[model samples]
Target: MDARSRLSRAIGTPVLFCRHANRLYHRRLGLRRCNAGGVDPFDADWDNLLVLDACRYDMFERRADLPGRLERRESRASTTVEFLRANVDGRDLADTVYVTANPQLHQHRESIEARFAAVVDVWRDDGWSDEHGTVLPETVTERALRAAEEHPNKRLVVHYMQPHYPFVGADADFDGGDFTDAEADEENVWVQLLQGRLDADRSDIWECYDANLDRALPHVEEAMRELGGKTVVTADHGNMVGERAFPIPFREWGHPRGVYTPELVDVPWLVYEDGPRRAISESTPGERDAAADDVVAERLRDLGYAE
Candidate 1:
């Protein structure tokens, strides 16, 4: 094993080390990354890839009114960082430019810059919404459109952090902004629901989640119209809301990495073809500016992730 894997296993032996434990559990179950027979999205044919963060196939199947041939695919991981490590990190993607509102990419920013043609950090570009505590879908849409115009020869990957958390839709009640200022337990709704601290019912949470997805679809459609190409709208992974975990039979809340439940790993693969495909050619890897560690941590917190 490599040094990282060895250290991960050592740290994962303790249940208290949640992150390492999550990784170890997936590894032990033969479900980590490329091991679970999941599709490697980069291998798929597309000129543009639109990723909806924490979006489930079932929810998307029922709700999304966009034009496309929709299908289902098992994702390589159950979380964004895991997906990045599996499908994006350390890869030669100099023909592509990624425009993203998801700050989790900051963890892999260095490697990403060395691999892709360019990366537009929407979060750092005033895309973050102070009122929403997360970047709204519209911000990602506008940036992606600009990226498409700027890098006409490259493939595009637009990742939108929506239907994920902070529930910024009209019906959402727990729309707390500046999550860094909130109490630790209260900042993450999923954590609160898991610990029985959240007062809202599970069904209500599901409704709000659906509402958030509803709020993003129009923006997604708008981007698709503006950036015409052979585009695929998919997700990094799906969310789990009180679904029963495998073997242990415990109910799962949120998308905790390593739990390869269908609710967390199954995602939608919708293809929308318009205009001609871009003539993609890889030049050399490009330079990129990354947000600071403290800034990324704060953004992650605002996006409902603990530092």
Candidate 2:
């Protein structure tokens, strides 16, 4: 077995948490990328790819009112790191520019550089949402617009961190952690719902989720309109709100990777064809910028992840 597989097995994160956590830890270790673990980005045929973080197929099917051909597709992984490793790693990203607001990508920023061509990380200080901890859709829009213009020779992959957590539509902020203190961090919706701080049926909580998605959609629309190619709206993975992942049989609140249930892995593949395809003019390799480790650590902490 290769070192990556041997180390992944040694860690036992896949069996412990799921394949998702294993992938996360693997990426953190700077191990060789694994294509056997998940989806390949180049498999899909599109010029512009918009990934809505934690967006589900059913939720999107019911809520996405935008103009596009919506289809359902199975996702390879059920979490952020898995998605990144599966799609971005081991790919020829020389002609691709990734514009994203998801800090999960930032947490594993180094792995991203080795795999993809360029990444416009908008989840940094200037774009960071003090209220949300994640960059808003508007921020993603501006950066995606900029990335598209800057990397005219590469395909654009705009990833927006909305419909994910720390619900911005409603005041679902996580300042000090006072949750059930489960395996999940205090900030995520899973902990809040488990603690009775948030209600699932109530419109306020659900409405906030809807509003966050709404807030993100327009910016993606703006990017699609400006980029003008075979733009597709999709997601890295889906979310789980009180859905019981079979075999586990208990009620699950948030999307935890490795539990390959339909709710968490089944995502929407919406295609938005804007005129004829435009050929990218040039190619730039992905580069890693000098980042403050402490700043990134704190950002991960705020996002309810281990630093």
In terms of lDDT, which candidate is strongest?
1
- TM-score for each model: 0.87, 0.79
Off by over 4 Å in 2: 1-39, 110-113, 172-187, 192-204, 281-286
How does model 1 fare in lDDT? 0.79
Candidate 1 stretches greater than 4 Å from native: 1-25, 29-35, 110-114, 174-187
Clashing pairs in 1: none
Full-model lDDT, candidate 2: 0.69
Cα lDDT tens digits for candidate 2, 197-302: 5544534455666776877777777887888889888888887676555553555566664555778777888888887786764455745676687887766665
Q: Counting only residues 3 or more apart in sequence or on different chains, how many pairs clash (N, Cα, C under 3 Å) in candidate 2?
A: 2
Local distance difference test, each candidate: 0.79, 0.69
